[model samples]
Target: MHQPLDIKDKSSDKNSIKVEAFRKHVRTTKPHKHNNYFELIFLSQGHGTHAIDQEKIDIQPPMVFGIGKEQIHYWDMDAEPEGYVMIFRSDFIMNSHDKALLELANELFSHSHILLSKDESITQFFSLLAKELKELTVSPYVVEGLLKALFGKILQMALHIKPTQDKSKNLYQQLVDLLIENKEYDRKVENYAELLNTTPQNLNAICRKIENLTASEVIAAHIVKEAKRLLAHSNSSISEIAFHLNFKDSSHFVKYFKRHAQVTPGAFRSSSLIEKRN
Candidate 1:
């Protein structure tokens, strides 16, 4: 069994945000999943493969990758990686109650990665962010404000660079959006199909075309992702997690987890705890 590494930011003040150059840190290059924070990585120079949720993406310079919390991922860099890594808790942006900001953040998280070319404005923003991170006396609000501006700019660039939209792709993106939004209460393909005003077969076909996975698999994957996050990061018991995820019974939840994860829920939790301790 491959245990996913749980990486934590151990800043002295327990700050909700962290920004640093990627090559400065020396750590093992292993498969891992972040616990509760989202990651935005800017790669200015690198050649490698980035695996996210079973999808392998080729590395290209001047690209940005956005990863939501608990998404399994790893890096295999053929050469030294160089760029800035910005990590911040999801609640840090959600709690702001700025609807536009929240929507932009959500949009960025919707994609596995975004391709970019060197732009002077983006470069200047990153430089400003790096400077702000060095000034320990800067207020938290100031830092957060800067982050919001950076995200806004990224969102704008993404909008312009997004590939031509088609009906099939749009529907597929909607399915993904709904999966993230309603992972707890609704886990049925038919339910999502009806919500999209399409039949289950049609929905499945769209999903297959977009991601090579059926609609049911997509829903199950999101549910399992959330379940793992709760097991690893929360103090919730197995029964509690089952209930929270709308599982009818703990036994059924265990079976489902085992079927996909190749380990029972209890065993997974125990291993996760042991990993944390080490």
Candidate 2:
């Protein structure tokens, strides 16, 4: 069994040194986090809901799934799906000159970039990608070249993506950066709008235009995302978790969690812990 991606610090020295791949079951998924490794899945088998970030999609055969370290995701298994999951340390491509591509690769897998495309060319590219992964297991030089190609493919797809527009996106991204950096979940939109030198309405309009997300949507995203993190890791009480998240009350936090996640906070926490122990 494997720990949830959240509990293990993928950025730790332990995850920094190796590239590994194998088949794994859903039981190993406990809402864990990945901090160091960039992961890709050639889910040749399996059928179920694959929850990544806020996107929940069904897993069909031959899907190319990407997960990054910061994304808290889970597989609620159904139909006994089995697949190949490959994890490689980020340092494996640390010295590459193609900063944009490498960063896109990391971001795509790390969950920062959660959008996926239904483009036809992606299928052909992934065919080559799967073949390269096979070669990497037997040849280091081949693996290195594959890594570079993988990075390039990531950028190519990203460039072709239709931007997710939101109305107050400038404020949203800024506030998201602010909250992520400061570790505050309850910050107001006005706070961000004020800092951006715009009215809340103006900021909200931009985020909605850019991402189809409202100012509140952006805020709730940050809060719920972090709540998922705490639920997966620390064995803190619901009340304590509320306090840590700066919620006005435990009930408010619980309601917020359920609204965004479709589960009570306690349920999510307990489910993650049980999955890890199983």
Candidate 3:
């Protein structure tokens, strides 16, 4: 029997947040998904590729990668990597009840990769954060403050690297969050709009404004993305996948996948297998 992608736990049971030197833990990893945490990696030095879902990024110094909980990623480092890795869960933010901070994190986590310019402030921030995390008497308030500042610095640099629209009171982010949270493959724009407390037209307007796609398109895109993940990472057959995704039948799923991805599910799976082999 074919095995599924590995699911790894990189959490700190003692605290909601954990920070460590990346070099100490740096190694090539098989494709895996983390268990319910946000991972932020800052590399001062590294060489190789980091594949997050479908996108493979070149490892360049002074860069950061924010891996979300649902993303599948792997490292193929050709050299020793020097960096810091910070792991935190949503519980850390939710416990604070800081809506602004939660929104900031949501925006930052939306991007999987960010190339950074040389910034002494970022290095200093990470160093200070690591030091604080090591203290026997760790201060939650101080850690929270440091995290905010560090995230701000990284986001500031991210703006210059890739300009994103202001997501203040971001309905699009909310919609995406709901989509990711959902498990039953309910990809209806009307259902999501209702849950978001807005009309489908308004949701579409917001989605189009932020993502240049209709709400329906955004939902379809998410469905396709999940489909691709299941195809590549799971050992389920097309019929099983269709059932799991709540499609009426396997034939319907095949047509839908083809309409969006321009290839049949079987073809996609075959290509994924071939890619894995070589």
Candidate 4:
């Protein structure tokens, strides 16, 4: 199982955030997921396909993509990409007292992507942020303020194209939340539908309408995600992991993993170890 890519601040400051030019650091084309921090990418120059949560989005320059924590994604770039990638933890924004900014951060993550027309001011914001990052003497408070301003700008752009609230979205989110919370013990779509006080058909329809996946697919995806995490990060044996996830047996677990991941559990673990070594 491929472990999610967890990028962390190596700086001495425990609550540190990171900002860097995109082209200088990103080299891989492999698909992966982030474990903790939210990622905000400003694409000033690039052409590629961004796969986020199983949706393929064509990368258009002068657009921004905000990825929430624990989301799976990858980039397939046709050319060298150039932009700024800002990664910060939720606590970075939570430190601020600005209620509106906090709400915008939540909204940005919920949406996952935004399209912005060519704007010099947005480009300038990233440039200034890069400069601040380079200055060793810049105070943490100043950096926090810059982050808030950047989020504020993103919020403004996001609001312009925000869609009206709908029942499908609400139902989908509720189902996803329940699946995530109970993935360890519950894998049945019917159980989730019952917990949400809806029929299996209704749940499936809402999931299909909102995420292009059936309710069973959504539940399995969450379970597979957790399984991958354990396979990559833990020292548990295959049988132990199977029992932990409430599988009937190790053979059944292996069959399920191969059906979904297209690789045996041991092979996945080996590949993940190789990637980590590199």
- Winning model by lDDT: 3
Q: List residue ranges in candidate 2 displaced over 4 A.
A: 1-6, 10-18, 24-28, 35-38, 47-49, 53-56, 76-99, 106-148, 151-182, 186-206, 228-236, 248-278
Local accuracy of candidate 2 as per-residue lDDT tens digits, 57-152: 676564557765466676676666544455666555555565444444544443333233333554444455457654535554555556556545
Give per-residue CA lDDT, model 4, range 1-278, as digits (tens).
32235444322345356777787446345555665566888887777788775467887777789876556667878767888888876667667676545555655666667877555777778888888877868777677667667766765665356633454665676675565456366878788888889999999998887678888888777777767767766678888788878999999999988888899889988987896586
Spell out the clash pairs found in candidate 3. Answer: none
Candidate 3 or 1, higher TM-score? 3
Residue 184's lDDT within candidate 3 is 91
Query: Comparing candidate 2 with candidate 4, which one achieves the higher TM-score?
Result: 4
Model 4 compared with the native: what TM-score? 0.59
lDDT of 2: 0.60
How does each model score on TM-score?
A: 0.60, 0.54, 0.90, 0.59
How does residue 12 of candidate 3 score in lDDT? 62
What lDDT is reached at residue 200 by model 1? Answer: 100
Tens digits of per-residue lDDT for model 1 on 9-77?
433346677777786343235556775677888877788789776567898867789987657677877
Q: Residue 266 in model 2: shift from native, Å?
A: 8.3
Better of 1 and 4 by lDDT: 1
Order by lDDT, highest first? 3, 1, 4, 2
Worst 10 residues of 3 by lDDT: 160-169
The Cα local distance difference test for each model comes to 0.73, 0.60, 0.82, 0.71
TM-score, model 1 to reference: 0.60
